[model samples]
Target: MDTKRFISFEGLDYSGKTTQIKRLKEYLEGEGFKVYTIREPGGTKISEKIRRILLDKAHVNMTGRCEIFLYSAARVQLVEEQIIPLLKKGYFILADRYVDSTTAYQGYGRGVDLEMVRLINEAATYGIMPGTTFYLKFLPEQVNKRTKLSGRELDRLEAAGLDFYQRVFQGYEKIAENNKNRFVVIDANQGIEQIHQKIVEVVKKRTLEEL
Candidate 1:
């Protein structure tokens, strides 16, 4: 399937991806475009069930391999049940996270083998990929600080310590470097409006170019 209308946002928790996605969706709709926003591990009914299991703080002992497989399972379901169909209808699909999240969080954070992670991600995505991925870049320390200030309860993965998050951050850096043509690195530390403006600018340019 053509993915020119598929845009994804990636970042650690508290990196403001959800907010940015909401803004982008609103902006797209205001421009008279059909927009669909979905979150990874929990878009379709089946996927949402897997998402609950994956994020439950009670599942602390889940193995890295198991975690990756579960994530891939959810992803494949969302792709087959939701993403592909939305794209076919000419809707601009915005994903909160995608395959790269698995590479960063499961492969790097959990110390899973990179080669194995690559294969699983390829299988789950069925060769479908986002046309543009906006990575909200922020240091692990900054994310931790925001989490503490927010006083929100941490999920299983979010509760992973600073070292784990650091590895994930580094993984994202490597992935972005390797896929420069598809990744757009954005400074997430900026004011919300500032970041939104930058994303809108890039989205506008990309959509126009694709057209």
Candidate 2:
């Protein structure tokens, strides 16, 4: 057992990340691995407060730049308060979302500067990149069908229009272009069982089990 591994799932809003995170957690625990699961912007106590400002429909008027920093700030708190400690205790951290959301939603989707996105996350996060990241590549149209994120159509970033979501998808692909060693681009369009099987393959490859 590697004993130290951090994993995260990244994608656009309504991309089935939360559901998949729950399933993955159950699978890992069943395999007898100590796991800790958390979501960005809403993981820790103080950070959850930040999540409200970032996601509430009433905050729809938030400037793109402001949105970027809020997420970074929340993540910084999450790292210092929660994630790092669990990792230090030799737990496999299963993160629902992370810095990649900023790159996708704020930078590519909302037309913010990608460099600015990188700098903010780099400054805030405590060097906790995942050993493996599963990017659930899904189109906004399909995501909307399943999730239909009620209460608000979508935030500024998500409401940037479908064209922007396409660019965000490309942006995520570009991230994987160079960092292929640590990123796994999965076909999320498949049925959940198929997707789970692919995920299991990756997990088995990275984290072994003697069954």
Candidate 3:
């Protein structure tokens, strides 16, 4: 078995992040690996509280810097209280969204300082970055159409409009480029099964190399 690996899924909303995460988790567990999954900003009690405020659409006035801090706070708690312990027990950690979300959403989407975001995120995670991050790539207009079709009510972040997401989409591109070794960009436009298969292949290949 590969040394307990940390994997994260990153993408814009309605980009099939949740669907693919569930599929991968089930696949790993079926293979007898001790897989542990958690969503960003909400794995622990304290973090979940922070998540509520961050997602609340009514809080439209939330400042960009404040957004960064809240996300970092929630992340720190999840990292300390949940992720580390689970990793120590040999569970493969799969996160729906992680530090990269803050980089893309707040730093790039909200125009906060990217360097500051990276600094705080590194400190929060104690320098623990994902071994592999599967980035589901999509365009902002595509995301808009998908959101409309999904029938899901918009959250505060989603309500920020398409321009914001366009910036975020580009941010993910830069992030993936900057961290080529750690990021695997998947074309989310592919059929669900095709995307999942590509992810599985990457995971299996990396596991062998890393272990």
Candidate 4:
């Protein structure tokens, strides 16, 4: 696989990953690159269904183990059905979440075993890993402020509370530390345009390096 073409964005909800992704997609398109953006736990018919189940607040009883399996199931389907094919066709794939989310949210926040999470992630992705992952760094409190400002209802995961989010935040820090070669930590507190500029610069540099 041409992993260099596969980039992913990771962050807590309300961290501006969606905005950055949109900006990057437009920038890539302007540069004559075909960009394909897809959100995790989604991007296919079966995955979309899994996404709904995973995010539905009504499923509050869902266990962490079940959550892990469902997310992996969605991811495997997406990898085989959409991501792999698009990468083969020379598209720049921008993913809005990936295996890292499970490592942070499920393994750390939900108290699942990290080794188990690692195995599940590897299986789900078919050993496919992104060449670059932009992690938007934000504290749980900052996210809460953003959420309140937006006045949006919380989904199952988003409503996981401050303590849970704190664990996830720390988990992300550890993951980024261990994967420094592939992880780019962006301060989510920056101005939107500043963040976008940084992302564009990094992508441009990586593109050149890969070539």
Candidate 5:
């Protein structure tokens, strides 16, 4: 096991990041590795409060700058309080989402300045970057299909129209292009078991390389 490695799962809404992260955690634990699973914007108590404000459906009037700041605040708390400490002790950290979400959603999706987004993310993360980021690629139409299948009302971010989501999708592709070494894109339209197996294969390969 690569104890010091940090792995993050990224994708569009309803792209199965939560499910895959859970499975990866279980698989790692079964291999006798200590795993710490954390979600962005809600890892710590203070951050969870911020997450509530950010995700509240009623907050339609929130400004883009405010949204970015709140997310960065939550990320700072999570990294300082939980992520950094755990990594120092050599734990395998699996994050559901991280800095990339901010860059994609707020930066590209909401039209915030991309450089400003990077600055905030760098400050919040304090250079503790994820060693590997698994990006589950799916189209906006697929997102709608999955959302309907789940039978859940969209959150404030998810409620953003298809155009916004397409922008976010493009943003993710660009990020993946620029950071090919750190990103492993998986086609998320496949079966759950197949997707999980592909993720496991990439993770195993990357862990060995890191070691």
Candidate 6:
């Protein structure tokens, strides 16, 4: 396989994307492949700071336009500070989230202009996209049920109501359809190991000739 590649896992909250990415990273690294993992809105120092301000529950009052812009800004920093450099060094860069999150959560979920969100994300990353993007599909209700935030307060995005998330989920599906070659949809209801196996299957199928 082309071990030197860029990949990403995308989904709504509690879709087990993070866990899957971590496992994939471990698997790749254990096999002597260079692997790097990152989460969107953070990844780099500046981006992480911006992430805190944007996701903090105290920022609930922040305007939707501003929130989207901040996400784009953080993405720009991550691209410059981490992702691009790692890719240049031939690491298989795996991201937990990327522009799709904003495209889904902000554009569709919050009713921002979808085109505008795409433009902002494009400008942020300068069009640095992954070789493949794995999108985990699930219902908003399912995700919320899995979310275990008892005493800890949830952020504004995390606390965003269910109906909004349904729209976001639909947005993800459309985005995946819209970007057919780059996007891969997975039945996220599967167990963690199963999901990982599915990812490996896709990778094997897609990269078989190339690898």
Window of ten residues with lowest summed lDDT in model 2: 148-157
Which stretches of model 4 miss by more than 4 angstroms? none
| TM-score of model 1 vs. true structure | 0.98
- In order of lDDT, best first, we have 4, 1, 5, 3, 6, 2
User: RMSD to the native, candidate 1?
Assistant: 0.8
Ten residues in a row with the worst lDDT in model 6?
202-211
Question: How does each model score on lDDT?
Answer: 0.94, 0.79, 0.89, 0.94, 0.90, 0.84
Q: In candidate 1, where is summed lDDT lowest over 10 consecutive residues?
A: 202-211
Show model 6 residue runs off by greater than 4 Å. 1-4, 148-152, 207-211
Between which residue pairs do clashes occur in model 2? none
| lDDT tens per residue, model 3, 49-140 | 99999999889999999999999999999988988888788888999999999999999999998889989999988987788899999889
Summarize candidate 6's per-residue lDDT along 140-166 as a digit string, tens digits.
888777776434466777777889889
Clashes by residue pair, model 4: none
Error of 3 at 43 (Å): 0.4
Candidate 1, residue 140: how far the Cα is off, in Å: 0.4
Question: What TM value does model 3 have?
Answer: 0.96
Candidate 2: residue 208 Cα off by (Å)? 2.7
Assess every candidate by TM-score.
0.98, 0.89, 0.96, 0.98, 0.96, 0.93
Instruction: Report the number of backbone clashes for model 6.
Output: 1
- Model 3 root mean square deviation, Cα atoms: 1.7
Cα deviation of 19, candidate 1, in Å: 0.6
